[model samples]
Target chain A: MRLPNKTCAMGATIARINDGDTVMVGGFGVPGTPMTLIHALVAHGAKNLTIIKNDANEPGMGIDHLLRAGLVKRLITTHLGLNAHAIGLMNAGKIEVEFNAQGILAERIRAGGAGIGAILSDVGIDTELAQGKQIVEVEGKPHLVETALRADVALIHADRADPFGNLGYVATARNFNPVMAMAAKCVIVEAEAVVPLGALPADAVQTPGVFVDHVVALETLTEEYAVVER
Target chain B: MIARAALEIESGMTVNLGIGLPTKVIDHLPSHLEVCLHTENGMSGIGPTLPSDRADRNLIDAGGAYVSTVPGSAFFDSVTSFAMVRSGRLDLTMLGAFEVGANGDLANWKIPGKFSPGVGGGIELAQKARRVVVLTTHTDRAGKPKLKTECSLPLTARGCVARIFTDMAVIDVGPEGFELVETAQGVSSADVAAATGAPLRIPNTALPSF
Candidate 1:
C-alpha cells in the first residue's frame, strides 16, 4: 500500500515495526545502514528481533546497540568478526547467529524477491555451512539448494530520495539495500536528503518508489560511525 | 610475493583480489595494465586505496579499506555483483589461504575456535573463476607449513586453486601433486620441500629463481 503522503513520521512508522519481526538492514559497514532508524527501533525497545544484514556494525555502533539491549533473538549475517560482543554472545549460547556465504545470502534474497523457491549453488558444499542443508545432484554434480530469504520489513539507507520514495544510493552503500527493498513486506527508507518528486533522475534511481513504503528524512549523519576502525 | 603474482594478471582481465596478501596485488600492477578490479561489495573498476584525507566513508572496498573508483566504474547491488562472479565472468581470483591441499582444496575461512568473517565471497569466486590463484606466506607465524596433503581446517571450496604464490616458492597444483614452479632467491629447493606439509613434485629442469 502507498504511504499516506509518501512521508512517515519516525514515531508513527516505527510503531508499526512490531516485536519478533524479521528485519533486513542494508549495509556492509556503516555506509548504507539506517542508523537513525536502527536507534529508533532500539528506543522503541522492540524485542526478539531477527536481524539480517552484512555485518554487526562493530561494538556500540549501529546494530550492536540493538544486540547490546538484548533485542536481537537471532542474527542472520555473513560477517560478525568486527563485533566481539556478538561473537561472545554466540559462543555463550545467548544468541543465535546463522552465517551465510555473502554471495549466496544476497542471491537468496534476490530469489525471494523474484518469487523463486530455491537456487542451486556449490558455494559451501562439503563444508561446515553445508552440514544440515540438502545436497541435490544436478547432472551428477552436487549443488546445495539454498532457499529464498524474505523479511517482515526492510530498513534501508539511501543518499537521496524523492518525496515519492525513489532512492539514490551512494558508492558501496548500494550493496544490499536495493535487493532487500524488493524482498521485504514493508520497506522504509532513511534518506539523507529528500527532494521534490522529480528531483532524482529516472535513470539514477537505484530503488524505485514502487518498492518503498515510507520515506523518513534523516536529521544529520553522525561522523563517528563513518570511520573504518581497522 | 604480491609483486610476482601481479605478473600473472593480463590486460583486460576482470580480477577479484581477496583480502590479506592478495589485496597487495593491486599496488604491484603495471601502471598501464587495464584489468578491471571487482570488489564483491558491489563495485567494478576499483581504484587504489585512497589517502585518508581523500577517502570517502561511503566508498570502501570489500575489506573496509577506503578506495577510489576508476572513470568507467559502475556501481551495482550485491545480487548483480555476485551474479557476475557465480557466472564465471571473473577472469582471475587471487585469494589468501590458511591451507591449500595438494588437490586444490582451499581452507581459508575458519580456524577451529578463532572467529572468521564467514566465507564471504571466497567460495563462489574460487569455484567459478577462470583461474584461481592464492597469495599467502609459506607458513604461519609459528613457521608451520600451510600447504597441506589435505586441508585440516574447514574447507572453503573443493579442488579450486590452480596456483599458489608464497614467500618461499611458486607452485602449481597439478594432478600429480604440488609441482615446484619456481623458488625464491633465499629459499633452497630442499628447504622448500621440507617446509611443505604436503609432498612436493620437483621439476626435471633447473628451477628458476624469482
Candidate 2:
C-alpha cells in the first residue's frame, strides 16, 4: 500500500528511535501519555534512552513500562515519589536521575524551545538541586543559572490532529505536550483521531503543524483509563 | 491548622496549595468568597473534590485527586502553568513543612533514610508567590520540635516562608525571628515558646485570633 502523507506505520517510526536518545514524553499521570507509541518503542527494543518528563508514573503505568523494559538510562523529572520502581532503580544505582524543581523543568524546556541558553533563579539556591550550579549575581542578588533542556525526540499524545499535524489536547491532559513538541528535534505524535486539514480551528490548535514531524493515528484509540498498566 | 491557613486566603485570589496538610486548606475556604486554585499540573479555577462516580479520570489536581472545575477554569500546558507561577501571578501559596527555620528557610521534600523521589513545584511556588504560608504540627511524629533555628533536613528553598500555622499557634517569620502571632484556644504564649525549636518572640500588642 502507498504511504499517506505525514502518517506512518508505528513500526517504521519506532525504528528511527535510537539508543541514548533523549526523549520527552507527554502526560501528567495517565491522561495524555503516548501509550501506543511507547508500546511500539518497547517492542522495537531500543535501550540506553533518556526520558524527560513530569513524573515517573505509578508502577505498571505510563513511563514505568519503559523503565520495566530496561530502556530508559536516565530520567530528568520533577518527582517520582509515587513510583516505587523508579525509586528502587535510583536506589539500586541501576539508573541515573536528575531532579528539577517542576517549574524550572518546564521553564528550561520552554527556554530550549525558544532558543534561549539559560535562565537564572533563586528557587533551589540553598537546596541539593543547586549544589554545583553556577551562581551568578545580578545587581547584587545571587541566582542559580538553570540551563535549557532540549531533547532528541518528543513522543506526545494528542486528542485530535489534522492531516497537516495541528493538534488539540483534552483537559489537564494538555500538560506537557505542547512545550515538548517545541523543544525536540523530532516530534512524533500519537493522534487518537486524524481529522482533515482546517477541521482543527486555528484558535483551538495548541501545537501548530510546523513543529510536528510525524503523526501515527491509533488503530483503535484506547480508553484513557485502560492506559493504566495495572 | 488547615482552617487557620484558609483564613489567610482572601477573596478572588489565586492560590497554590502544596501537597499534604496544605491541600486540606481547600475544605475550609469560605463559601461566600471566590478563590481560584492553581495546580502545578496545569490548570486553575479548581473546585472541590469529586465523587468517584462523577469524576472524569482525565481531570485531576496536581496531587492526583479527582477535582471539579470552577466556572472560569482554563487549561494550559506545563510551560504556561509554570510561567504563571514563576512570574509572581499567584497571590498566595500554602505548603507543608518538614522543618521551618527561624529565618524562614523551608525543608519539606526529604529526610535521611527516606525515599523522597524529588522536589516538585514547591521550589518556585515558595520563592515567587506573594505570600507563603506553611501548615504543620508543632512537633514531629516523635514529638520533637519542628520549628528550628536552622533546618536539620534538606532545604527545599531559602527564606521563602512568611507565616506558619501549626496545631499550636500562628507564627510569622519577621526580621527579628519567629514572632508568635496567636495561639490556639486555651494555649498560652509560653506553651508556644516551649513547643518551638527556635526562640519565639511575643510582641507587646494583644495577639489576634487566627
Candidate 3:
C-alpha cells in the first residue's frame, strides 16, 4: 500500500514503540546516521528496542544517547567496538547483547529482506558454535547451519528523499541502510536533503523510497550531543 | 613424534581452532591441560561437546545460528570476541587450508559451488595469535593433496599458519618448506607423498596418532 508523507516530528510521525524492532543506522563507525531520530526516541522514552546495527556509535555520537538513557533493552549487532556507554551497560548487566560475525550479520539482514525463515550455514559447526543447537548429520558428516532473524521497523538515513519515501544514501553511508530497508516492515528514512517525488535517479537510489514509510527533512546535523551520565 | 606434536599444544593454551582437523584436538587434548576455544563469533572457555536442544533459537556461532552452550561457556557481544583474538588473548589458532605457501601463507575460505557465508574475524586471529595451526583433509575430492606452494582459493589470512594437520599427515608449514611433522597411523610418508600434490620436507619419523 502507498503511504502518506508523515513528518518525523515527534509524536506526529513516530507514534508508538512496537515489539520485534530493528533499526539500521547508516555509516560503519558512527558517521552519517539519523541522529535526529535517535535523539527523538530518547526523548520519546521508548523501551525494548531490538537494534540491528554494525557498531555501537561512540560517545556523544548516534545511538550512545539512547544507550545512555537506558532505552535500548536488546541489541543484535556486529560490533560494539566504539560505544563506551554500551560497555558500561553490558558490564553492569543492564542490557542484553547478541553478537554476530560481520558478514553473517549482513546475510541475516538480507535473509530477513528475502522473507526466508532461515539460512543454513557451514560457518560455525563442530565448534563452540554448534553448542545448545542442532547439528544435523547427513551422509556421515555435518551439514546445514540454520539461523533465524527478521525485523519490524527499520530506521535509516539517506542523502536525498522524496515525500513518497523514496530515498538515496551518500558515500559509505550505504553500508547497512539499504539492506535494513528491505528487511523492515516499516522504514523511516531521515534525509539531509528532501526533494519532491521522482527527483532521485532510478539507478542511483540505493534504497528506493518505496521502502520508506516515513520521511522528514532534518534541520541540521551540527548539534553537539549533551550526554549525561546515567 | 607425539611428544613433539603435543609440545605444539601446551597447558593453559588459548587455542583458535579451525574446522576439520583442528577439531580433532578436542578429543586428544591432555586432561590436565586447559585449552580454551576462542571461536570468531563469540563464546570462550568452551568445553569439548555439543548440547541437545535449541534452548536459545537466536544464539549462533561464528557462522550465525543457534548453538549449544558448553559447560564452561561464557557469552559476550562481538567487540569482545574480536578483542580476544586481536589482543593476544589467544595463544594459538589452528587454521584450515586450501593452499599453503613455502613461507606458511594460508588460504581456507573460498571453495567451489559453496557460498561464502562470512570471514568472522579470522584475519585478526591469524595476525595476532601466538601460534597458528592449519588443519585440513590431505586431499581434495579428486585425490589431490591440498598442500601447495601458493594458495588457489580466496585468502582468509596471510603469513600466520605454522603447522599443518591433515587426515593423512601432520605437517609443518615452516619457513623453508612444507615439513612433514607426522603421518596418519595407517599411512606411510611415501603414501602421503604420492597423494599430496606439492613437494614436501619429511624427516624420517614414525606417524603420530591424534
Candidate 4:
C-alpha cells in the first residue's frame, strides 16, 4: 500500500514501466479511469505492452492515447473498430492484437481472477477466435473454449481510497475493476484523491488495498481522453 | 381484429420492428399513434424508411448496421439499446415469422444453409417479451404456406407469439389455439388454410376482415 506520485515526462517516472506487461483497464469508454497513471505509462516510455481490456481506446479518451503515443504494441481486446489509431497501427503492421467478443473478453478476465484453468463458452466457436485456441469436444462437438488469464499488472481507477489503498468504483466504471483486482500480479491504483488509512468504508471497497502495490494521485480530475495533438 | 390489436398499442410506443415483412408495420400506424422507433446500437426515434437519401452513416441500428436518424433521434451504444430489449421494457416488438406451429416455435434468426450472423439478438428478444406480434406473408411463393406444421429451420423462440399479422390473413395465437382473426382484402379463410403448410384450426364467426 504505497503511493508513487510520479510526474509525467520524467525519465525517472518510467522506471516502473515494464515490458510484456498486462494492465487491467478500468473505464467504460473514458468515463472513469486514472488518466494520470495512463499518461505516466506513456511518459514512462514502455514498449511492446499487452493490454487486456474491453475495447480499443478511442480518439479522445481511454487507451486511444496509448495507441496514439505509439508505445503499446499489442492488445487483447474485443473490438478494434472503435479506436482508429489502434486499428490504423494494426493495419500498418506496427502492432499486433487478438480481438475477442465483448462477453468472451469479460469472461476470460473473470476466469483469470477466479483462478480457474479456463472457460468453455462457445460464443466464438467455429470462427477465427477458435483458430488457435483449444477446442474441447463436449459430447462430440467443437467448442471454441477460452483460457484463463493472468496479468502482470492491474492498472485500475477507484472512486475513494484510504491511505491503505482499499477503494470503491464510482459508478458504471466499476464493471471490470473488482474482477481485474484478482487477475493481475501487481495492482496499481490511480485515484483522484488519496486519504488516510481506513478512510474508505469496508462495504464500499470494491478493490482492497492488499492488492494495490502503487497509487498515483491526480490534483483534480480532468478530461484525459483528449487526443495528444501536441 | 385490427381495432382489437389497436387497443394493445397505446401512444408513445417505442418498438423495434424486426426485418422483412414486419418492417412494414411502420406504415400501419394510425397517424395519431406516436411510435418511437429504436434501432439497436443506439438510436431512438428512427426516421421513416431509410433508403439512400436518409442513409446517415453516423446513425446505425442496434445490430451495428448504418441507418437513418430521424428529425428527433438519440444515439447511445448498441449494448445499451439491446439491454432495453432484453430487459423486457419495450412496449411491443413486431417480428417476422418463418414458421409458427401449434407449439409456437419461431425460426426467423437462421436459414441453416449459409453463414449469417445468425441469432444475433432474435433469441433474446423473442424469448422474453411482454407482447410478441409477428408479420409475414401468409403463403410462400410456390403456393406452399409459410405457416408450417413444424419449423424446418432452427427455432429462435418457443411458445411466445401472441398475435400474427400477415398480408393475406391475421391470426391470434392464444391458449385455445390458432384462431383466424382476419382475412385480408379479397382473401378467404379456406384460401388462408390452403396456403398454409400445416393443418390449422379456424375459429367460427371470426372471419375477421381487417
Candidate 5:
C-alpha cells in the first residue's frame, strides 16, 4: 500500500475555486501568505469572492491584488489598518467588510474545523463588535455566540511539505495556516519546499496531509514574500 | 511617557504591547528584565525588532515589523496564541487609546466614518488582561483632550483601563475617577487637570514627577 501523492500544478488546483466561493487565506503578514496561490487565483479570475484573512496585506500585495481586480465582494477579517485601499472600498460600499476580534476569528475558524456549531466568548460581549450577535447566558454570565466560519476553499502557505501533503510552518508564519487547513472543503497549499514522503519528521508536522487536498511547491519566491521595508 | 509606562511592567509578568506607543515601552525595559512579551500574530518571548537587512522574513510582530525571537521562545497558531490572552495567561497589556473615559472605558478601535480600520486583537487584550494600562498623548493632534469624562467614540471595551500614562501625567482610574498619580516634569497638576477632559483629582501631598 502506498500513500497517494497530493502534489499538483498550482493553476489547476486554484481553478477549483468558483465564483462566489468563500475563501480562507492563511497568513498574518507576508510570512504565511500563499503569494503563489494568490497570484494563481488572480490569474484564475474567480469573482465575487468572500475572503477571510487576518489582514488585507498592504496595497499591491497578497489579497490586495484580488481587491484591485475587483474579484472580492466581501471580506471577513480582523483588521485592515495597513490597507487604505481596502478601507476605501469598504467605506465606499464597494465591498462589504465584517470585522471580528482577532482571537474570536481564530476560535471561530477552529470551531468550524472541529465540526462545532459556535463558541461562546466574553471577549466582545460589551463592545460594538457584539452588536446583533446572539447573547447566550452560560453559567449565569453573558457570552456572545461567535459562529463557526467554514469556507469553500482555504489557501495555505507552508515552509515545508511532503508529497503526502504533511506541512510544517516556520516562526510566526505559522499563524492562520494550520487551522485554516481544517476548516475548508478544499485546502490548497503552496510550500517553499516539498520534501519526499517520510522526509518530514512525524512530530514536526504541524498540519497532517489528511486535512490538505493539494500541495503546490514554489519554485521561486516572489518579492511579496520578502521582508517588508516599511 | 514610555519610560514611566515601562515601570508598570514588573519582572516575570507576561505582557502584550499593542502597536504604536505601547510597543515602544519595550525599549525602556532593562536588559536584564525577566519578561515574556507576546505578540498576537503568534509568538511569545519576543526579542528585539530586527533591521531589515538581517531579518528573517518569517518572524514578525503583530504590527508587521520584522523581529527576532529570544531564548525559550515558542510559536503557535493564531487560535492558541489568542487562547493565552482570553484565558488570562497574560499578566498585563498596554494599549494605545483614542479616548479613555473617566470610568476606565476605552475607545480606540474605531472612530466611525472618520477612522474604522477594525479591531485586531485589541478587544481581548483590553478586556482580558490581568491589568490594562494605556499609553497615549495627553491630547489629540488638534489639542483636544483624549482622557474624557465619557468616550464619544465607539468603545473597544467598558471600564477596562486601570492606569493611563500620557505625555503630561500618569493617572489611575479609581472609584473616584481619574486620580493624579504623577505629573511629568515641568507640568503642574493644574496643567494636567486643564488638559484632561474629565475632572482630575489631585492629592494633598506633592506629586512625584516622572
Candidate 6:
C-alpha cells in the first residue's frame, strides 16, 4: 500500500481561490507566514477576500501586498498593531475588521476543525468584544459563545514536509499553521523543504497529510522569510 | 519600576510579560531566580532576546522580538499556547495599561478613534492569570493620571488588575480602592496621591521606598 502524493505547483492551487472567499493564513508575524503563496495569491488577483491571519505583516510584506492590491474586503484577526495600513483601511471603512481575543480565535478555529458549533468562555465577558456575542449561563457564571471559524482555504508555511504532505514546523513558527490546516476546506502548504514520503518522522509531524490538499516546495526562500530587521 | 516589579515574580512561577514595559522586567530578575517565561506565540522557558545577527527566523516572542529558548522550552500551536493562559497555568502576568480603575478594571487594548490596536492575548492574560499586575507610567504624556476613578477608554477585562507598578509608586487595588503600597525614592506619598486620579488610601505608617 502506498500513500498518495499531494505535491503541486503553487500557482495552480492558489488559482482555485475565488473572489469573496474566506482564507485563513497561518502565521504569527513572519515566522509561519506563507509569503510565496501570498505573493502567488496577489498575482492570482482574487478580490473581495476575507482573510483570517494573526497580524497584517509589516508594510510591503506578506498580506500587506494583498491589502495594497485592494483585494482584501475583510480581515478577521487578533491584532493589527504592527500595520498602520491595515488600521487605516479599517478606520476608513474600506475593509471590515473583526477582533477576537487571541486564544478565542485559536479555539474558534480549532472548534471549526473539530466540527463543533461554538465554545463558551469568560475571556472578554464585560468588554466590547462581548458586545454582540450571545451569552449563556454556565454553572452560575456567564460565558460568551465564540462561534467556530472555518475558511474556504487555508494557506500554511512549514519548515519541512513529506511528499504525502506531513508537515513539520519550526519553533514559534508552528503557531496557527497546524490548527488552521485543520479548519479549512482546502489546505494549501508551502514548505521550506519537501522530501520523500518517509523523510519526516511520523511523530514529529505537526500537520498530518490528510488535512492538506496541496504542498508546494519553495525553490528558494525569499528575503521575506529571513530574520526581520525590525 | 521594572526592578521593583521584578520582585513580584517568585521562583517556579510561570510568567507572561506583556510586550512593552512589562517585558523589560525580565532583565531585572536575579540570575539565580528560576521562572518559566511563557510567550503567547507558543513558547515557554524563554531565553534572552537575541541580536538580529544571531537570531533564529523561526523563533520569536509574541511581540515579534527574536528570542532564544532555554533548556526546558517547549513549543506548541496557538490553541495550546492560549490554553495555558486560559487554564490559569500562568502564575503572573504583568501588562501595560492605558488606565486602571479603582475597582481593578483594566483599560488597555483600545483607545477608541485614537488608538485601537485590537486586543491580542491581553484579555485572557488579564482575566485568567493567577495574579495580574500592571506596569505603566503613572501619568500619560500629557500628565493625566492613569490610575483612574473610572476608565475613560474601553476595558480589556473587568476587575482583573491586582497591583500596579508605576514610576512614581507601587499601588494595589484593595477593597477601598487604590492603596499606596510603596513610593519611589524621593517621591512623597502626597505626590502619589496627587498623581492618582482616584482617592488614594495612604496608610499611617511611613511608606517604604523601592
Rank by DockQ, descending? 6, 5, 1, 2, 4, 3
RMSD, every candidate, angstroms: 1.8, 2.6, 17.4, 9.8, 0.7, 0.7
Winner on DockQ between 1 and 4 is 1
Residue-wise lDDT of candidate 1 within B1-210, one digit each (tens)?
778999999999999999888998899998899899999998999988987778888988888889998899998889999999989899999999999999999999888777565677778888889999999999999999999999999888889999999999999999977999999998889989999999999978999988
Residue pair clashes in candidate 2: none
Q: TM-score of every model?
A: 0.96, 0.94, 0.53, 0.55, 0.99, 0.99
Error of 6 at B65 (Å): 0.6
Over 4 Å off in model 6, which ranges? none
lDDT of 4 by residue, B96-191 (tens): 777776566666654443322334445546755568887776765556677766677666667778887777777777675576777887888898
Error of 5 at B142 (Å): 1.4
Candidate lDDT values, in order: 0.89, 0.87, 0.63, 0.63, 0.95, 0.94
Tell me the tens digit of each residue's lDDT in model 2 across A1-230: 52235877788878888988999999888778887888888899889999999998788777898999999999999999879999999988999999999988988998898899999887778788988899999999999999999999999899899877789998898998898999999999999899987688789898988888899898796554442322
Candidate 4 TM-score, true structure as reference: 0.55
User: Model 2 chain B: which ten-residue window has the lowest total lDDT?
Assistant: B50-59
Candidate achieving higher lDDT, 2 or 3:
2
* Docking category of candidate 5: high
Instruction: Report the CAPRI category for model 1.
Output: medium
Find the 10 residues in a row with the least total lDDT in model 6 chain B: B108-117
Q: Distance from true position, residue A133, model 6, in Å?
A: 1.2
Supply candidate 4's per-residue lDDT for A56: 61
Q: Global CA lDDT of candidate 4, please?
A: 0.63
lDDT string for model 2 (B118-185, tens) is: 88888888878888989999999999999999998998878888999999999999998899998898
Model 3 spans > 4 angstroms off = A1-10, A19-26, A136-144, A223-230, B1-210
For A37-116, candidate 6 gives per-residue lDDT tens digits of 99999999999999999889888889999999999999999999999998999999999999999999999999999999
Error of 2 at A157 (Å): 1.0
- Candidate 4 residue lDDT tens string, A1-230: 65443223223433665876767776544434556667778777677788876566566566777877777777776555446667667667787777655545556777787789788755535234456887788888666678887888777777666656677654234545666766887777767667766567678676767766666565666645322222
